[model samples]
Target: MTTKRKPELVAYTVTGEGEKAYWTRIGSAWAHKDGEGFNLDLAALPVNGRIVLMQPKPEGDAA
Candidate 1:
């Protein structure tokens, strides 16, 4: 049997640089059982932006 786990990180499409950067949520990633790699699920792929992985924000904390 296989169990589903919550995503360990959130994926974002980043544009610009430094303080003027923009981050948009684009996907999520889950670690493999062996911790060797991750599986990424993206809702929208970017054509000219960088893809970044970050830890998800805590519940109810909107920045």
Candidate 2:
């Protein structure tokens, strides 16, 4: 058995063409113990530059 913690990073959509560009929250990630890479939890990875890793936005800023 194991426990879960707050996500270390978030995944989102930031890829597409001109008018098609859009943003959407997709998943989260956790830093690996080795500090080499991350353990990802994603809905689905995009083919292009469709996903990016970013810190969670500050609370109460906006939705």
Number of the top-ranking candidate, with TM-score as the measure: 1
- Where model 1 places Cα greater than 4 Å from the true spot, the runs are 1-4
Candidate 1, position 16, lDDT = 88
Q: lDDT tens string, model 2, 1-63?
A: 133877889898777767886778888989888999988888777766568888987778773
What TM-score fits each model? 0.82, 0.66
Q: State how far residue 2 of model 2 sits from its true place (Å).
A: 9.0
lDDT of 1 by residue, 1-63 (tens): 133776899899888899998888998998888999988888999887689999988889884
